[model samples]
Target: MRNTAKITTAVLAAGALTLGLTACGSDNDNAGADAPLTVAATPTPQGEILTYVKDNLATKAGLELEVREFTDYVTPDTAVQQGEVDANYFQHQPYLDDFNKENGTDIVAVPDATVHLEPLGVYSHGVKKLTDLKKGATIALPNDTTNEARALKLLETNGVIKLKSGVGYEATPKDIASNPKNLQFKELEAAQLPRSLGDVDAAVINGNYALEADLSPAEDALVAESPKDNPYGNFLAVKKGDEDDPRVRKLAELLTSPEVKKFIQDKYDGAVVAAF
Candidate 1:
């Protein structure tokens, strides 16, 4: 009962954004109350979570939902911005903020619609512990802005490295003030980090990608971000003015409902934590 279709970067780059505009038309047409609200999401937890809503909760709540899956992070926002999809559910605020500022896109979160938290994790095949990594060992990180800063923060938290004072979420390797082991870093796209584990000594991976790769954040991660007061809760987001669309509102309500909470807890265990 999963209503999902996968779109690759090639297709997106080949005028898929324009195609979305042609198909969905303007924001008003896309948000028509009777129409299905298409959402762009990454395949792991976001698409799966939305699929669960489509098959179960959405109908009961009088919503028609369609899910389109994308592997890369950038396309989903662009898809939403271009009206390729009505909304997206794959990113946290830091990422969204950076994307909007960088691309001049006006995507905004659906209010109070924070759904889940996929704790960022550090994983390795060669090392049993952070201290086990040898001098000059290379660790791969997500190359995008927010995630890279997040990865750096994770490393700093575990004492693997130290950043310059007050670098905050924008911290990068260039901010690293200390590296006791002189650990080298390989910056790759977030999707590629799990695959890079075999090549690098270790990698800090996003929770969703870790789940997609079948690495349990609860059991497999050497270290992970604590969810307490975490600002990275994944949520539903739409281009600027779609917040009040009836369909978006209904989906937002359903996304943060008790049913979705139970589904996340039961299906993902500690790998995905319900944020509502």
Candidate 2:
């Protein structure tokens, strides 16, 4: 009886070890080179661009690509940090820095993977030009930290408003040094800025949201940020240790390839500019 009990215990222990090994093997398989690289992106240019690569470039490059689209800014980074997705391609460095700092996530950009720049633009339904806006006019701005500062800077550049001296990407309404037009500011989510145009005199919209609403940054904007010397070029990002994944490297290469650059110019017609 004693010998039988000891044998039973040993068998059970060995079986458990085998199951644990199998589980580890399964995890390794999922992280293997051939596994699909799932990416999260906003729908407009980022999703469209990734879809293009998946359909046209990925197979030829020996990569399996999957793109998931999210409308809001917060989900993609969270997804990447939680390992829900392999990577994301919807944000610039400043915004990623701020997100990581605030959320305690360790997301990092792939080196040299800056794909494109979507110039932030001010759009208005009733106003024909930035200077034409009436006094006490209410203008909508994105409520996010980095983008709000970018919007304020654009407004300053167009002589619509003024920011405090030496205020950089962290600037806010509180940082305004001058208000020549006495503009009333309305802060809303970036995704909601397009719909706010009718409610406000003008709106500073991120380029992706503007494109989703069929508004062209080049043609429709009262004032658009200049691409030259702009620091807000969106890039591919991954969790802290996944930068060396071969699939990520392949996608990064494909994103910066000449084909993508041509595609951006032709498809967007100057609305989206390739940074690579």
Candidate 3:
């Protein structure tokens, strides 16, 4: 009887050891590996911003910050949506709103500085100023809603176009109630606006694209959008569930810091205003 009791106790102990080993294996499977904080951004301004953080801030924050660069607008948001990236720094509120509506995405804005406001400036190849352009001068601008409205507003500001009464913010080309210049507007790609400068009498150019085309916003713009009122101000973009993430907060902190402010001033000059 004594031998049988001991045998039963040993079997029970062996069973407990097997259960414990299985639990440990399950935990190892769940916690597979540590991944670094991955941030994706466009190649122009936002890329520059993230590069600063990745080069400077990541070491102190105890993070391996990997920044991926995307060329066009569609893929960055798509990458974030598909969980290919942890975060992305790109696009303003209006652009984001349009993207979310069209794609059925729930990506959220993480707190970050408005890195740069790409001023929608109307520039002329032949004429020096707004008054110098002839009546019925052909004007070129981006066809997109955000940029088109911005161009129209600037035109209205310079007494070129009179929009509908009470159409303060939401004014569109269709809202143009009067065209005193009879300026024919040619809707082109934002990237193509700089090229259209020599073709048309004038064109409204985005800052980054203008830079790519070797046009200086500081020197060339006959009239540029104010950094204060410009709608194309960009921000840090993150996945829907990660707004409250610690890494995102840290990255945002680094972006809005005094160091970055100086970097913007030193590097971009007046072209990219630090919109913190």
Candidate 4:
């Protein structure tokens, strides 16, 4: 299961930092018979999936695949846009779309693999359950366009609020038609939502940042985005014309391999489902 959304974005400053392979050297070309093709990936599932390839698949493919690790969401897209990397295995289509729209660049998905589906979960601090909320409890949500709508939709589905008669993917918190609990919506930066958890009654958080804060989606989240009901499935991002790149195809193949699938099953348990 997956959850995704399209969001319009505001511009953020990014320095064009070139990430070279510390061990593999500058061999991005298809020039040498044994030269490596470099790909950039985010820390957890994407980079973890690439580690499997680095350890197992690259040798058999007659290629040495180098992966650069990234933490900030902005840098990978910026790196990809500058042609500093051949592929990136971090964002979903929505984030990619926003990054392109904001930056006026054309990074595309080379291989469409929803390798990991991290949900938006609402967890409480003082209250053990949602039923414990007072009439005017405050619940924080991500302020960004895509995630804010997602948080509201989740709240609506859980009977926490009521939205207008008919609204689609682009709906925002302003679309909420009812709020019986008088739940104050505290909108914060997605990256900061988890840190604010201790102060609020409950907070809706993205899974990556949750995990970064040492909260596992399978464990600490009170209620989360179930693949059974979400759209933002993460993917492999690449430059627009390079979808057919051989290394991209192979990397996607290896990621979806049974070994990787079982690894996800064993590691993340139910938190990060492998939608490969």
Candidate 5:
């Protein structure tokens, strides 16, 4: 689940300072090959899944895993790019691409044996279904590039709104081609959408945030992204040159193990789907 923590100027300054020190030889690349691989993850499925591997699977596979939980999106990638952590496991490819383009960071995904798709779900306390949404209903949406577009697509898929043809992941509220219900849009930070439910008619929430809020998408989402052919599955990621590190390979293997697939299926009960 995402937290509403302010990414303050001080935090950014501290991150820059850490980047400088990391370059002078304190990074994981210089550590012993068997050193614990620290992974930064969002708290819900990513952290919980890593913790499972750490407690029950890492030792037999000859891996030392340390899971560091982050409540916001920026820090995890920032921490990994700066070598403050060995890798991170919380973002989809689209978001990662956007981040790299915007921040001038060179993070890349570690190919997993399988991918896990966290479907963006539309949730509401006021309505039981999308049809129940009234005209002029206020809906909360993610303000970020990838997710806001993804959220809008979900609505379009459910016929809540229609988007311009060929406008897919790049679609924004401005791309909406039709809104028969005349719904109102309230765009907020992705991390803040879950909490905005009480203030709006409904909210389009990221799957991880929905889980952190204890909302089961399978049961509660008015609608969610379909796993079939979905390109947004989240994967373990690392700084460009670190992809081949032994520790990183171990964690990636564990993440795709049979036990992990079963854990996800049983725990999330379809809220989270394994890509392999």
Candidate 6:
């Protein structure tokens, strides 16, 4: 009887060991597979869009989506370049090109990953229209090269300002050929433009920041970038050699999915537009 009891205990211990080993093997197999794909983005549309994906789509698709919000342009790209984050979704190609060139970072735009365009719009509190502004009325613009140029182009397109013939994406206030309103440009960081509206006659605010401040570009903008052939759509980006990372591919697919398209259309109300 004693021998039989000992034999039974030994068998039970062996079974437990086998079960534990199987469980550990399964966990090991899924360790990296289940790891989160962290992406950096700006708060309004980019962060909101990613949050939608994470809440509605990621679990069903088996994606562990994580989003980090950034207020400035420089950090997201640098984080990806340093492998601090898996991907980023805040910048257009032109801005990325300038960033890579200036910072000597190898971050690359995800292949075929045009996500959304946040049309740079001129917004104001003092005037209902761009034409209503008094001469020499101060207008604030983003100080960054890419957005400053874009803001100038928007002004030029609306006939508020004119550029030197053939002054392209790199245009600046110095490139303005005519300022019929004699509009004075106060150059501030993009994030600060919304707050500057009360102090300045008008401010050109990027779509994301504009949205964050509860200003709808579609309704509030005095003038906005025409979507046709606009090249400043924001996109997902990864480090150069990390392009083929499966997590990135999954996110890229999800970002351009029909569901995301509908979400953008419904949520932003034309303040944002689908680029893919």
TM-score of each: 0.92, 0.89, 0.80, 0.81, 0.90, 0.87
Can you tell me which runs of candidate 4 are displaced by over 4 Å?
Answer: 1-34
Candidate 1 lDDT over residue span 177-217, tens digit each = 99988989899989889999989999999999999999989
Best by lDDT: 1
* Whole-model Cα lDDT of every candidate shown, in order: 0.87, 0.86, 0.70, 0.71, 0.83, 0.82
Q: Rank the candidates by TM-score, best first.
A: 1, 5, 2, 6, 4, 3
The TM-score leader among the candidates is 1
lDDT (10s digit) by residue, model 4, range 1-276: 122211111111121133432323222344344445567766666677777777877678766677777655776776666666667787766677767787887888765555778877888778766767899889998776667777888888878888898876556768889988888889887767888988888998887777778888778876777787457887777777766666677767777788878887887777778876
Off by over 4 Å in 1: 1-26
As a TM-score, model 6 comes out at: 0.87
Query: In model 2, where do residues sit more than 4 Å from their true spots?
Result: 1-30
lDDT string for model 3 (95-174, tens) is: 78778887888877776545667666777779898888898889897776666777888888888789888874445677
lDDT of 3 at 20: 25
Please report the TM-score between candidate 3 and the true structure: 0.80
The 10 consecutive residues of candidate 1 with the worst lDDT sum are: 1-10
| Clashing pairs in model 3, backbone N/Cα/C closer than 3 A | none
- lDDT of candidate model 1 versus the reference: 0.87
- The total number of steric clashes, by the backbone 3 Å criterion, in model 2 comes to 0
- On residues 1-276, what C-alpha lDDT tens digit does candidate 2 reach at each position? 011111112333453224221111122125889877778888889999998998999999999787777788997887677665678999999999999899878889999899999999999999788888999999999999999999999999988788999998788899999998899999999989999988999999999999999999999999899999999999999888788888899999999999999999999998999997
Which of the two, 1 or 6, has more TM-score? Answer: 1
Relative to the unseen true structure, what is the Cα RMSD of model 2?
11.2
**For model 5, what is the alpha-carbon lDDT of residue 83?**
72
